[model samples]
Target: MKSANDQATALLEFRLSAHRTLGPKERDLISHLSWRVEELPARQTFIHDGDKPAHSCLVLAGVVARTQYTAGGQRQILSVHIPGDMPDLQSLHIGRMDHDLETVSATQIAFIPHKDLNHLCAISQTLNATFWRESLIDAALHRAAIFRNAQLDADSRLAHFLCEMHFRHKAVGLVDEEGFSFPLSQELMGEVLGLTIVSINRSSQTLRSLDLIRMQKGHIQVLDVDGLVRFGQFDGTFLHQRFDHETLARAS
Candidate 1:
C-alpha cells in the first residue's frame, strides 16, 4: 500500500517539473489536497459510462484504461492512465462520464471530492491554472494517439506506442535498469492500438528482429534507443514532458 507521502510524491510528478523540486505555493496546494484512498483488484471498473461521479480518481499505482463499447458490446480501450494521472480530471467540469474507467492491474487510487477541488480552485488562481493546464495536456495526448493510429502502419504504430509509454513511465520515475514496467497484455494493447492480436504478435516480432526491444514477461526492455526512435518516427514533443527527449530515451 502507498502511504500519504507516496501519494503526494506521485501527485507532484504530474507534469510539474522534470527534476526540480516544487515551489512553496505548489507544495501548499499539494498539502491541501484531500483524498480517500482505495485499492482495487486487477480489471475492476472504477467509473462506468454515464455515471455522474462526485470525485475524480488519481492513480497512485498501476494503470487505468478509458474504454468505450459498441452496441454489440465490442470494447475499445480509448487510452491508458499511469501513476500520477487523474483520468477523470475533466469530470470536474463535465458532469457525466462518456466512457468507462477501469483498473488495468491491481491499482491504488486517491479519490478527491469535487467539492474539495472546487473549493481549492476558487481559493487559488494558481491551482485553477494548474488544473486547466493538465486538461490541455490531456487533450494533446489524445491528439497524439489519434495521429499514431491514423497515420502509422502496424509495426511503426506499435513502436510509437512503446516509445510513448517509455517516456511516460520515465516522466514519473518508473523506468529502471531493466526498463519500465508494462502490465497491459497484448490483447489490451491491441484494443488500445486498434490492431488485431495477430498483428500485435507480428509487430512485436518485427521489433525484436530489428533489435529494438526485448520483452520478458510483462516488462519491455528498449534496446538501441536511437534505432527504436527512428523506426517509430516518435516525437516526444506532443507529450509535453519536462524532461529532454534524449534524457528520456536512454535507459538507466
Candidate 2:
C-alpha cells in the first residue's frame, strides 16, 4: 500500500501535468478540491443509462467500457476508457447519462464530485475552457470511430483500432515505440469493433503474418510502426490535435 504522502505526491504530479495549461491560481483551485480514489472490481458498473451522474470519474488504471444496449438486447461499445481519460465529462452539461460505464478489469478511479467541479470551473475560466475542450475532443473521437466503422473493412478496422490505441497510450506516456500494455480480452475488443471474436482473432493472425504487430501475455508490440500505420490508414490528427494552439502554446 502506498502511504498518504506518496499518494498525495502522485496526485499532485498528475494534476500538474494534466492541467499544465492552466494558470497557477487555476491549478491551486484544482488542488484544493477533494478527490476520492476508489477501486472497482472487474465487470462492475460505475454508471448506467438514465442515471444522474453524481461525480466525474478519472481512470487511474485498468480499462472501462462505455456500452449501450439496443432494443434487441445487443450491446454496442461506444468507447473504451483508459488511463488519463475523463470518462464522465458529459455529465458536466447533461443531466443524466445515456450509456453504461463499466470496468473491464479491476480498476482504480478518482472521483470528483460534480458540485465541487462546477465550483472549481466557475472560479477558473481556464478550467472551464479546458473542460469544454476535452469534451469537444471526445466528440471528435466518436465521430472518427463512426466513420472508421462505416468505411473500413474488418481487417482494416482492427488495424485502425490498434493504431489508435498505440497513439492514445503514447499520449498518456504509457507506450514505447513498439507498443504498450494491452490487457483487454479479444471478446471486449470485438465489442468495440463490432466484430465477432473469431473474426478478430483471424485478423490478429493476419496482422502477425504481415509482421506488423505481435501480442503475447496481454502485451502488444508494434513490430513496424510505419507499416502498421499504413495498413490501418490511420490519421494521427484526430488524436494529436485535441488541444487548441493557444492552450498547447501555453502548456509548452
Candidate 3:
C-alpha cells in the first residue's frame, strides 16, 4: 500500500510513460504533483466523451481504455492503457474528451488537476518532455488501432492486441512466465478487434488450438512467441517504447 499523497505510483507511471529514463531531478517532480486515488469499478466511465475535465486520470493499477460509441450505441475501444499510464492526458489541451475513458478492470486511479500538472511541467524541463512524450505515444497507439481495424483480419487483430498487452505489461515490470493480468472481457475484446464477442472467443480458441496461446483464469500465456508474432503480423514498432527492448534485455 502507498501513502495517501500518491508519490510512488505517480512516479512509476511517469518513468515507464516514456522511452527516456527519469533522473533524480526529474523524479523530484513527483513530490510536486497533487492527486487523490479513486477506486472505480469495471465499466464505469470516469471521463465521458464530450465533457471537459478539470483533472487528468492516471492508471496506477488495473487496465483502462479510451472508448467511443457509434450512433447505434455500439462501443469501440481505441486503446488499452495499463498501469503507469495517464489515459486522459490530452484533455489538458483538448479540454473536452473526444472519447470515453472507462475501467476495464476494477481500477485504482490518481486524478491530478491540470493546474497542478502544468505548474510542475513549467518548472521542470525534463518533466515537461516526459509528459509530452507520453502524449505522443497516445497518438501513435490510436493510429495503430485505426489501422488495425481498417486493414487487419480477425486473427491478426487479436494477436496484435495480445502482443501489445504483453509488451505494455513488460514495460512496468508486470510480467512473469505464467503471464500478466488480463482483466479484459470477451465483450471488450470484441470492441477492440471489431468482432462479435463470439468471434473473439473463436479467435482465441483457434490461437490455442494452434499452440500460440493459452488464456485461463483472466491471464493469457503465449505458448509460442514466433508463431504468434507471425500470425498477428505484429511488428510492435508502433508502440514507440524503445526502452522496451532494454527492459527485455534486463529481464533476459
Candidate 4:
C-alpha cells in the first residue's frame, strides 16, 4: 500500500517538475499539500465534463489527456499531460471541469484538496504564482493548438507537437535530443492532430522514411533534429520553457 508520505513526495516532484522552480518556502508548502494516492487503469476518466471536483489530481506516473467532444460526437483532445501535470488545476477556482480528464496509460495520481490549496495560496504568494504560472502555460498550449490546428498541414502540426512535447519533457528531464517515450496510439494521435487515422499513419511513416525520426521500443528517437524542427515549423516560445533553463537542469 502506498502511504500518504509517498503521495506527498510525488506531489513535491510534480510541483518541482514545472518549467519554473519554486522557492524553499514553496517547496515546504508542497510537503503540506495533503494528497492521497490513487491508481487508475488506462482510459479511465478521472473527471468528466461539467463535473465539480473538490480536489486536483496530479500525475505521479503515466499520461493523461483533457478531451472535449463536439456536437457531432467527435472528440478533440485538448492537451496531453505527463507525470507532474495537473490536468484539472483550473478547477480549484472554476469548481466545474469544462472538459474530461482521462488517463492514456495506467496512472498513479495524487489528489490534493482544493480547499487546502486555496488556503495555502491565500497565505503564500509564491504558491499562488506557481499555480498561476501553470494555468498560464496551459492557456498558452491551447492558444498554440488553435493556431496550429487551423493553419498548419497535418504533418507540420504533428511535427510542431513533437517539438513542443520534447521541450516540455526536457524541462522535467523526461526526454533529450535522442527521443522520448510515446505511449499514444495512432488513433489518439489522429484525434489530437485533427487528422484521420490513415493520415496519421501515413504522416508518421513519411517522417520515419525521411529519417527525421526512428521509432524505437515505444520511444521516438529524433534523428534529424533540425530537419524535424523545420518540418514542424516549431517555435519554442509558446511553451514558456525559457523561463528557467538552470532550474530545468537542476530538476532533471
Say which candidate scores most in lDDT. 1
Q: Write the per-residue lDDT of candidate 1 for residues 1-252, one digit (tens) a residue.
A: 756654654564344544344567765776667678888999999799999999987887889999999999888998899977889999999999999999999988888889988887797677677777777888988998999899999999999999988878877767777897899888889998999888999999999999999976779988877788888889888877656443322321
TM-score of each: 0.91, 0.88, 0.91, 0.89
Worst 10 residues of 3 by lDDT: 243-252
Candidate with better lDDT, 2 vs 3: 3
Better of 1 and 2 by TM-score: 1
| Model 3 collision count | 0
Estimate candidate 2's alpha-carbon lDDT, on a 0 to 1 scale: 0.77
TM-score between model 3 and native: 0.91
lDDT (tens digit, per residue) of candidate 4 on 149-173: 9999988888877777776776666
Candidate 2: 10-residue stretch with minimal lDDT: 243-252
The residue pairs in collision within model 1 are none
Model 1 global lDDT (CA atoms, 0 to 1): 0.81
Ranking the candidates on lDDT from highest down gives 1, 3, 4, 2
lDDT of 4: 0.78
Per-candidate count of clashing residue pairs (backbone under 3 Å): 0, 0, 0, 0
Candidate 2's TM-score reads 0.88
Model 3: per-residue Cα lDDT over 124-177, one tens digit each = 787788788888988888787777778788888888888878877877667778
Q: Candidate 3 overall Cα lDDT vs. reference?
A: 0.79
